[model samples]
Target: MESYKKTNKPRILNIVPISIGSGEVSLGPLYISSALKKAGFDSVVFFPDLSLIMHFPIKYDFIQHQLDYIMKQIRPEVVTFSVLSTNYNLSKSWAEYIKTNFNTTHIIFGGIHSMIEGENIIKLDYVDAVCLGEGEFSLPQYLELILNNKLTQENSLNITYKLKGKIINSKKEQVFLSLDEYPFPDREPLKYYYREGVLDSANFITGRGCPYNCFYCNAAMLNQNKGYLRFRSPGNVIDEIIEVKAKFELKKVIFSDETFTMNKNNLFKLLELYKSKVNLPFECQTRVEAINDDIAKELTNSGCESITLGIESGNEYIREKYLNRKMKNDQIIKAFHILKKYNIRTNSFNMIGLPGDTEKTIWEGIDLNIKAKVDSAACTIFMPFKKTPIFEWYQDKKLIIAEPNTNYYENIVIKHPNLSKLSLFFYSLNFNTLIKLESNKFKRMFKVFLWVKLFFLLFKGFLLKLIKNPLKLIAMNTFMKNYYGRLSVKGIIE
Candidate 1:
């Protein structure tokens, strides 16, 4: 709240751009910062340890220590908190604390949860506004308008403004048209606190939104509505890689799009462009439906080192009836076979317990992973996210967040009634241990000196993990991204 005292000039802060959960950076605020800079306003994004502050079941008084330091030291006019699902309450509390302590700044909130749960959040005492949808474009304009004393816009897409304690009903905007319009991330402005490593080059996103909405999963985590599908042009995408390569001196990339190869033609074209221009290896997350012999070969030829498929369940009944994945076991086998045939590694993402998943179904999943011959497999305990179709289904079934003591994680895991909590958790952990011991890289590498091909392949195996074994995999990647491996724009080069 120390930054907004002046009504004439502009200052800005963006938070949660780097979600502590996965050590992932959200490009939303960075793009907004670029647009604000272009518009002649001083802007920068902030990456704080929200989890360090939130500190679920293992809460400590020290959680607020870092937040206290930020409030006392940093001075900015407008601060925006990117609120994810469980972060809303914690961030809102922080915003309120800032408002009460320092009156010079205005606090705002935005992100998927902010949009989906806009009304409840704005009802909070400290939140001045909620950027209801894509905030990158709308935020800059809103800030510019506020600075110019024209803070009332009725038709701007995706913003919920509060005027004098009354909420304004402004219309939302369409999803971004061109993903290529945004600027590249500059580590200098962020004070150089980022993940950079062999895996750091592994942390770039070329697109936003997903086309398909699977139940039992939070589709709204990326973007809601029919507008989740938006990607950059091949040239634009290659240019981003070149920017990172030239700036960070990296030789590989990780395409973090939900369905990295969702558009068949677009994937091929982008691969060809990368081969001709960047000549770097990369991996991506895709669905079983997108893989075929031709598509898999093109991916390999274009330097795709590996791919991860979200095989949520091996049981056909659960896939369609519960998760809405709608894929057949034959297609799943075919996809993994193609990846293996091309000598490109593969990862299978399996869910241990879901709404209708029986213990046998979960075992079928483990068996499915083995039969598919995936290079790696990840297992995750399903959580009922707020706005997913299945989330609502659970709520209707009167299965809300019953245990206030429960964190987003659990030593024992189960999403629904079929599998008991303790049983689910043990099975998930056991499956993970087996996958690790049986993993291709684990069985073949470490004792070998195949550092060349081993580098990318081994890294791919690790990248496809973490979703399941969060304690080890997530922590390792987080450290690898930031303090552990410091590529420094030099180490990534040959």
Candidate 2:
């Protein structure tokens, strides 16, 4: 690796605030960096090596060393982090460390957490400013202002900062850029995506914003803007794919839209253009309600390899009352059947331990997934993230036991009136097994086996605690947290 010598060329570094092993080509930082580049400023994206931070015994010193190395190499004049609630504390700590050590460098926080917690975040002494709305729109303006020494609290739009011991919340409305006005997101930061001078797979968003108001998500909050649900024209999308294909061997594309099929006409036109011009196998995510026979047919004909549907919960009451998802179970089953009819692989995204979730309700969810006959399913515990409607609802009901931890898989933070954290943990361990075991004949035996396995795990945990082996115990818990869908019960029948 070559080092970029320190220069006075207004170098900017955008951080994803996660481990390098993830290999995620984050669109947020890429888009921001590209926007800055278009504005005539030098920018680079940095993904720190934090593999050691994944385990229970976090190697803080090693991570700090890696960060220091990158910071010294690039020597960015300004560092910006795209923060998420899951890594808010870690990002904060990193910011504090950078500000303390690299005192001259300016620090800016942006992303979902900052959009919701801007004023509070800017109150931190180390934070220079907090960016709200799309960075592609505000970041370039903010940087230009800083360069010209014209940046002031009154003039800042979509930015919150502290001035003269008082926090100034910008009153100006954010300028939203049309999708076509922006350049293609820079892909240089994602080294892993490029193999042998070809891109193995890439994630691109055709549009922004979702129509549904899922309480647990920030989409509803983001949709308040009049121009939130903007999309690039079908021609613009085709041009990007063709350009990328010309430059590299593109094996696949993943549309990371909130709802890829929300606009039926636009999606159909895009699919038609894509099929005729660039028929690369791709995947996308959409709501169950958005899928229909025509949509399925279009997707299949356009070389869609897979589709992920958000079937958050099985219980209708919980889906409607708690999550604001009003689709019926019949709709979900029908959608899956339609996709299957088109020979498209289906993956269902499910969540357990929601605010109103019970053992019976969780079982209902598993049963629904089985009925849907999904090829694959993923289940995650419900983490009450700050600023989400569910978190505020929980706060109103005094259900919050403690502030949410970084790991959503650790346990449920909310104090359910009926279900305990241990109970929810056990349910999460067995959730996938129940869905994959579709045979009623073997289900009874499987249920018994699951309980026995749970008891064995509990006993092992107790012994580890008794022996004062906290590190091993933490490792065991982490392993089990992600072990939901990996187990196979075919051996039992054999």
Candidate 3:
């Protein structure tokens, strides 16, 4: 094994602990890894086994073997796990294993889960520290302390540490970096997906954070309402896209911002620059409230092949009161109509099985997608994340069915008095089909194929588990690549 010791810098390994379905690279770890590399530290990002859903019972020995193999090669001094509430348990298990085998190695946790539960997570015996808020600047600073052998709880910003039998969170004020201060995320870790033809498009974020305080969304809770939305200059963004275009064979560009049309003037400038320079068909996500006729026209002119709008629930009461998205159904329908008018594709993101969800409400959601004539629809059961207002409300009502450490991708989290978990799962699985049926989008031949697809999905878990471990691993790899690779291009009809 090649020793990183020759570099005279501590080696850091970052693990992104999430199930991959869309073949998209995680930008969080890439940003921090790039910052560490720029600061002359040895850092690398690793993605463990990807699955369609988190609840699939892949073998522990296989998972451990993959990690052990990587550790033997890199032998990092510090191991960091980029965590989400859905994958916290998986990360905890890995962190504990690393601490047990490599007793001298330090383990750190970061990302949304850490921001919400840093103090509690740091209390774990294996976790040396939890990084709070943004880590691009703070993480490099933390590593400098480790290098100088001056590491202590008091010295780092945005870090919570355990020392001397006490948990200590840094008193230093957190520093927020401007978007341009960030170097382009290191795409080296994502090369495996590209080489294997799993990823066809590059995922980039022009900004960080969101302005809206949706109850179910963790953005507000993650930043603690510090007003963290910030975007890079249009020129800065174009430079990165130009660099990425040169580096890879990308078919499309995905701007994975929470709200791409947040600022009209800035967005227009970006569109103009993109149309003239990049000219590649790109897709982005935005709120229905952010859409207008002019915005829709600009998007299409700039080669926006698709735009995803969050229509979390169809029942107006459920949408406004429960999810805190105040837009009316008329506005959502209008947004989709305008995008479709301009020949740009539209996709709606819906959440079934939310609090106060009933069969009637679930159907209303499907009906709304049909009414809006959405080109594609995606649905997920709502997961109440820790420390969010919705989670607290669910707790107050005693409606949560899952355990405290439930997987984020669990089929159902809250138990409604009138709705069963099975019903909700059924609704989510058939959501798109129901919409297509109502909209008359499916032909007889297509309907037959859809039924077969639904059957495979309904019994997918059991079928995958029936396979032996070795075969299961191979089956899963091939399934994820083909399934998610198609999804990555679902919006592009041509």
Candidate 4:
């Protein structure tokens, strides 16, 4: 491959790898693309149409055909991938395919997977560079150097690039002290795929980084030595919301922060400003320990339709001892009650397949949700992602049954002494059934019929997998959308 002289404006394409049923939009590529556009570059975001290939095996030329189409249409000189661990292999394969076929395009990988696995990622022949940590500043600077023909060195801040078969790690980039300095995310590229009636909600992040270090989380690993928490100004957040409201005609907004209510002073100030300026119904995820009467009242007063709490496990011992979530069951119940008192809906997130979990413990989780009377609940099998403390524990204990796959809802990746994979599957359905039974207001006879109907639906779902029917894919997608919508507190504000 030969280097081409810098053009007046470089064409860049950002790719986001999403699975078939993933209906939500991603912000990483949008942010990076926004920064690129702000720097006066031609940038477009591309989400590969994975609907056809998701359930089937990819032929050798399948990716080639897709890449050829995109290359001809966009003629991008720089290609960047925002990938998660689940889609890392897919992104790598695409990058390798591009390197083999294209002559002038440069490949860059970023996101959680690349940030944690940069050393191994840069070793790949297809990966030209990896952006570490946040790319809001690092990516723009890298592109500026390329546009000016000044990126001749092997290393620079917040970037790891390959040169002469040698990998070089750049100096770490300074974290942005405040998030308000950046422009709003470039959602224009997403407008290409935005369906009219499906997913009318817009998502924005008011803050970055997490204050708590749960064993299953990657926040601590990603923000080591860097500041643990950084927030945008209230005025800036409200300004973005106002812009999105006018542009997208958004029905609702979702604050996709790890813990939206982490800082009480900031939270109160933002809520006050939001009530006066935007006043749109919004939802947020927060810690169980962070909620109180005052906070819940303020959230409702500020137009918060719903709140999501991470009651990861029901057993206090398991939650605190194993998962490092220090919230007690009483606190979880109290939080739900407080939200209920304020007429705010509540959603609880639970996890079942953990190292020390048994059938009893899993049932206890369901019991906790039922007792809390949450509007909806979601339970997922535990996945030990690479670089997380839980993954380290699984590796040391030799309990890992398989590599972490892209599917977290339907797959079990660890071997428990007492829990079989089949048992886990059945237990997940049981949890769903319990949540429905607890949430709905139906007669006793209808409830029994509903239970039977749900059981058959689960059984049919299993059979669909065996036959590899396309209807199974549709059913799974529908099931996921409904499940997430229910857990999102859909009707609370409406």
- lDDT tens string, model 2, 390-435? 8898889898886554556544677877676665665565465556
Tell me the spans in candidate 2 whose CA falls farther than 4 Å from its real position: 1-8, 19-24, 49-62, 196-199, 402-406, 443-494
Q: Model 1 clash pairs?
A: 1-105, 3-76, 3-77, 4-104, 4-105, 157-172, 157-173, 158-172, 158-173, 195-481
> Candidate 1 residues 1-494, lDDT tens each?
12223233476767662233333455556666777677666665655543443344334345566566565555667788877765655676678877887776778788777877788778777788888777667777787776666776464647778876678767554665577777665443432332323124535676777767687655445545555567788888787778667666555678877688778877888888889988888878888887788888898898889788988888989789878888888888888988999999998777765777886687678767877887777676676667778777777877554421123434332246776565555455445444433333332334244334433543454554455556655444443353113223433322
Write model 3 residue lDDT over 55-141, tens digit each, in one string: 245556766777898887778899999987777888998899899988888898999889888878988999988898788988888
- lDDT value, candidate 3, whole model: 0.78
Alpha-carbon TM-score of each model against the true structure: 0.78, 0.85, 0.86, 0.85
How displaced is residue 117 in candidate 2, in Å? 1.1
- Each candidate's clash count: 10, 0, 1, 0
Q: Candidate 3 regions off by >4 Å?
A: 1-6, 20-22, 49-61, 222-227, 403-410, 441-494
Query: Residue 45 of candidate 4: its Cα lDDT?
Result: 78
- List clashing residue pairs in candidate 2: none
Q: Evaluate residue 1 in candidate 1 and report its C-alpha lDDT on the 0 to 100 scale.
A: 17
On residues 370-459, what C-alpha lDDT tens digit does candidate 4 reach at each position?
Answer: 788888777777878788888888889898988665566767788876777766655664576656654564564574576577657566
For model 1, state the Cα shift of residue 358 in Å: 2.6
